[model samples]
Each structure stands twice: as structure tokens, then as C-alpha cells.
Target: MALDVQRNWDVCMAENLERVTKESDQPKDKKDARETTRAEKPKIWKSEPVYLPDEIIIQILEYVSRFHESQYTLASCCLLSRQWYSAAVPMLYASPYLYGKNFDPFQAVMIPSRNLHVRDSPLASLVKILDLRGLVHQASRRITARLLGRTKGNLEAFIAPQASFGTNSFAALAKCHQLRILDLSLVSESPPLFELLKTVSRLDNLTTFRLPRSSGFSTDVNPALITWPRRLENLALSGGIDAHFMHGIVALPSTLRSLTIEHCPSAKGFALMHMLRAAVRPLAHLETLKLANLPRLSGSACDNVLFILPGLTRLSISVDYITPALFDFDVSSHREAIECHYPTLPHAESLPTRHQWTDGKQCELRTLELTNSGNPGVEDKVSPIDIVIALDEGALPNLRQVRVDKTLLWQASATAADVDALADALKEAAVQRGEDESTSTGVWTF
Candidate 1:
């Protein structure tokens, strides 16, 4: 090594000496011109390579991951160098948005071989969200199960495809202990309710769970056999859950904070009321409730919901199932019936009467959302004036927001004055509560 270095140094000196000798042999004008040209040339400064700690690099990558178009940037970063590849590969695979064209490629990478021991990619373990809701004909049940098996180690959220998910997928799903959100609402052919609930019972970290719209709990689900995740906070129930199943759910987990029931074809008004009184009223931590699209519900089915769930802070109900009497106190048969059912209930006496209800104190409801269930004449069932009158009578004193659908014709000139009154009432309520004036507290139509 030393000899080779000495030889190269001698060769460089000889070349420099030859160049100098030639330059000295040149005319003074030529040498001066060469020197001036060299002086006019630009100089480049080389900077030292910067080194960042791994934690700082990871934080920056996380921020980039928040952008919707960050996947391309992250993919490019993976080829920079070993250090950059190590940092970017995980973020790139953490949450992949699979569409039709890319589904095959993604599956090939995740399941390189049918034999598990022969091929397994570390990238599968980096995935925290495996959303296959976009693919329809591109994947099959077996492939979906294999993909889940590959990602179950770290997967936190799974949105099943609309048609391909089946009983085979549940085995891998049960192993995903880190799952937080499971949305199977789009499944056309849902797996049996018994197997789904059994698999979900082991997910200790699950928080949000939505049942498929095709869920048919025909006979397998026993009320006493049902068990939910320990920390479940939000739940949605839909489809084929008839009066029998509705009444069978005697208890929901106490940790529940939000509950949504929609698109039930067989749920009658009386059965839902029974469930609310017997099962839902005992949940002390519940806050938000949404009910919509029940074809079997009567026009006056949900009028007594406010009386039954007095502790709810947010309620979204279809105007088809309610009337102006929804906000008006029914100290008659409805009130007596609720009291008759739960004689020891604490909020039984506080079911406000038209003459005695205090402003904002009688009702804890803060937001009311009105939706249409495609029923004719629903546009006139509940109006802006009706809500304004409710506010005037101090029915919902804490109500700050009222959202209506455009199908309700709330923006028509006939109801313009009433809408104005509703807005002013909301603003006044916000001000009385010492809330910001710029807060979105008024009526909104969609």
C-alpha cells in the first residue's frame, strides 16, 4: 500500500512539473490570458454530510405520513441509502390504500408463496392498517385470509372488502390483537354473527366496531353468550337484527360512549323502545346515539327517545320516526309508560312537563340532527318553526346545533323567518353559556 501511494505521488509531481514547464515556455500574453480565464471561473464549496438522530428522522417521516400524497414521497425515500431505506420502508407500508390495479401486486408481495415458511416479507409486519374496502373482484376469501395472516402481527385497523370477506377471514382476524377499528359495514354477504362476535371478543384493544349491513342473527346468537371487547367505545348495529334479537341484547358493555343503529328491516318501534329502556339506559358512559333508515318504524316511533335517554348529549334521528312532539314534553301516556317500565329509574321524575321544565336544565341534549328516511311528506313532518318553538318552550336549552337535510326544504322562503329565529336562538344559547360567538352553533343543511 505504501509503495503504491509513493508511485502515484511521484507520477502526479511529474505531470505538474511538465505542465509548469510548458506554461513557462508560453508567451507572457498567453500565460496572462490563461490566468485571467482561470480567475474568472466559479469555485464550488463542498459541505460536510449532515447526520440526524434516528428519533428525529422518524418524527419527520411521521409528519410526512400525515399528507394524503405522502406515499409517493415515502417510496422514493426508500431507495436513497441503507439508513434512509430502513427509516422510510416502515412508513411506506404502515397503511397501504389498495385499489384494483395494485391489489394483485400487493398480494404478491405479502404472500410471496403459499407455503408460509418458504416466503414471508418483513414489510407485512410493518402494516398497521390493511384497508381492502376498494377491491371487489380482484381478491378472494382465501387470499384475504392469507393477507390478514401476514399482517395480523401489527395490524390496527381493517376495513373488509364489500364482497370477498367470509368465514375464512375470521381466523386470521382473531389473531390481530392490536386492531382498534373494524368496519365491515360494506360486506354484502356477512359472516355469521356468532363467529364474528366470538372472534371479536378476544380483541382487548378494539374501540370502534361496525356490524355489516347484511348481518342476520337468525338463531345462533344467545343474549347471555354475547361478549364485547373490554374497551369498546363506539358500536354500530344494522341489518336483519329483528325484534327478537333487539330484545335479546339485554346489556351492552358499560364502556360504550357512542351507539348507532341503522338500516334495520325488522326493528319495530316497540322492540327498539324496549331495548333502549332495558339494555341501553344502564350504560352510564354513553353520550351519542344515532338512529336512521328503519323502514319498519312508525311515524311516532321515536317521539319518546328523549324521555328514555335523558343523559344523551347528542342524538341523530330521522324526522320520519319523530314529530314536533319529540321536543315537547308528553306528561301523558308516554311519560307514564316510561315510568311504569322503570319505576326506580333516577331520571324518571325529571321527564319535563310543558309547564315546569327549566331552561337548559331539564334536557342535557346539546346537538340534534334531523335526517330523512325516504318517506313521502317527511319534508313537512318537522320544520324550523317547530324547533324554534321547542327552544321557546325551553325543551332543549343546551341545544347548540341543528343539522337538517336539504330534502327537508328548510331553506325555502316560507321557512326563512323561522330559520333566522333558530339561528338567533342558537347564538343566544352559545352566548349564555359563555361560548365563542364564532363557534359553529347555528343551523346547517346538507
Candidate 2:
């Protein structure tokens, strides 16, 4: 070892001497000055490692991967090196928007039976959002279950496909305690409602849930039979929900903040009114209520809404359900006026009083949306004149935006003269009150 070391040192010194002798052969004093300059000059090319720390490099690549169209950038990053690939691979698979052409490839990757040693698969744990909304004829129910089984521990939001989601899928889904949102509204052939509810209620972290769209029921919902998850906040029910469920006190947990009921053919005005007065009114924190495409809800259906939920801020219901009574500023003082002028119930006075009406309270409604544009209930629906008069009389004083269909617009109404007169009165009232005008006294749609 010593002899080899001495030989290598001798070779290096000999090369150094030959180079110095060549430099000295060109003028002695100049060579000495040149050698001193070379020794003092800083080396521009660095020989030490020039790279970021693993943690910082990972963070930078993860940030770059967040852009919607940066898949190409992420793909390039994965090819960079083993460290880069490890950091970038997780982001690439975390939230897969699997649809159309890519569904097959993804299914192959997630299926445990097809791949060996999936028990400790890091790819399965990395997936957080698995949305298969575009699926139709591409997959089967068992495949969905397999996918769920692999991702159960970490899956937070899962939008099940419109088809091929069945009982097998729920077996895996019920175990996903970390789930937050499950939207199965588009399912056509769904599992039995009772079993479905029972399965999902076990999800401890579920917050937002959407029921199947085809869910109008023949009988009322049994609140006692159901165990609602306490963390749930947003719920959407289908048009098939039974009238008995709407009329009777249905099981709406107090945790709910937003509710949507649409395409309910069996829900009559009286049933809906009963629902708001009984089931919904008790929810203190309720803020957004949407009722749309409900054909059976006829004639001033939501007239008594303010009396039910005074704290409601955003409302979307059918046009026929709304009336001048809803906007009566002196509604607190004129209970008789509502009974006499209601368009739907001319004999409201004669009907049995199912609800113990509350003292008429001011609504916190800021946005009012009117749906069912094609219903064409010109005479029965709340008119623009009613809105103008209501605004002028200081009803819904805090209202800011009103949305309705283009058909509801009075831009070319044959009876525009009446609405115009009412609009002018509302403008004058706004000016008198020193408030900003425009609570949808202009062009609007739902």
C-alpha cells in the first residue's frame, strides 16, 4: 500500500513539474507572475454537490403538480430521478379524475387479484379523491368494491358512477370511516333504501350526502329505523320522497345546514308546508333550502315559509309556491290578509289548522331563486308586480339577488304597465329609505 501510494504521488509531481517547466520556458519572471495569478484566481466551476434538500425538492415538485394542465410537467418530473419520481408519483395518483378512456387502466392498477402483493401498496393509500362520474358501460359492481377495498382507509370523497354501483360496493364503502362526501344521485338501479341508509350512517366523518335522483317513495320515511351520522351537514333528497315523509316529522338531523328536495311529484303544497312548519323549522342553523321541479307543489306553497324558518338566507323553490303573502312587510300584523289573498288556497280559512303558526318574523333571505320556468302558471304564479310591491313595502328588506328563468322576465310583458308602476314605486321607496336599489326589479332568471 505504501509503495503504490509513493508511485502515484511521484507520477502527479512529475506531471506538475513538466507543466511548470513549460510555463517557465516562456520568460522566467513572467512565468512566476502567471503562476501566482493562477493560484489566487477563484475557481468558477464548483466541484461540490449542487442540489436541494429532499424535503424542499419534494415540496417544490408537489406545488408545481397542483395546476390543472400540468400533467405533462408532472410526467416529466417523474422521469427526472428516483427521488423526483418518488415525490411526483404520489401527486399523480392522489386525486384521479378517472373517466372514459382511462378507466380501464386505473381498474387494472387497483384490482388486488390481478396484482400480487397489494397488501402494502402505497398507491392505494395515496388516493384521496376517486371520482368516476363518467362511468356508464365501462365497469362492473365487483370492480367498484375492489377499488373501494384498496382505498378504504384514505378515501375522503367518492362520487360513485351512474351505473354499476351496488350492494357489493357499499360493503367496502361502509368501512371508509374517513369519507366526507358521497354523491350517488345519478344511480339508476340502486340498493334498497333502508339498507343503503343503514350502511352510510356508520360513516363517522361523512358530512355531505346525495341520495339517488329516482327516490320518490310510496310511503313515508321511518325516522326511528334510521341512525343518522352526527357529522352530516348537507343532504339532497330526490323527487320520489313520499308525501307522508314530507308531512310527518321526517328524520332530518340538527347537524344539517343545507337541504335540497327536487322532482318530488307526490309532495303537494300542503305536504311541503307541513314539512317546513314541522320538520325543517326546528333546525336552528338551517341556511340554504332548495325546492325545485316539484310539480305537485301548487298555489302559494311557500307562503308560510317566513313563519317557519326566519333565519333562512338562501331559498330556491317553484314560482307557483311564491306569492305576495310571502313578501307582506306587515305580515306580522296581517294574518287575515294571507288567508284572504292566498292564490292557492281560497278556502284556507275552512281547512283544519295543522300547524300552530308562529309570530310572523322577518326573513334573513338574501337570495331568492324561482324555478320551473316551463310550468307556465301565469295566473297562479307570483308575478313581477307582486315582487315590485313587496320590495316597495320593505318585505325581504335584506334581499340582494333574485334569480328566475328568462320566461319570468317582464322585459316585454303585455301587462308591463302595472309592473312598471310598481317598479317606480319601489325605486321611490328605496330612495326614501336611503338604500341601494335593485332587489331583482330588473332582468332576472333562476
| Poorest lDDT segment (10 consecutive residues) of candidate 1 | 352-361
Candidate 2 clashing pairs, residues 3+ apart or interchain: 215-240, 216-240, 216-241, 217-240, 239-263, 239-264, 403-445, 404-445, 404-446, 405-446
Judged by whole-model lDDT over C-alpha atoms, candidate 2 comes out at 0.73
Task: Give all candidates' CA lDDT scores.
Answer: 0.87, 0.73
lDDT of 2 by residue, 252-354 (tens): 8899899898766666877777667667878877899988777776667666776557678988876666666777544444454345334465454653232
State which candidate has the highest lDDT: 1
Every model's TM-score: 0.83, 0.72
Number of the predicted model whose TM-score against the real structure is largest: 1
For candidate 1, the lDDT comes to 0.87
Clashing pairs in 1: none
Clashes of each: 0, 10
* Model 1 misplaced regions, further than 4 Å: 1-59, 339-361
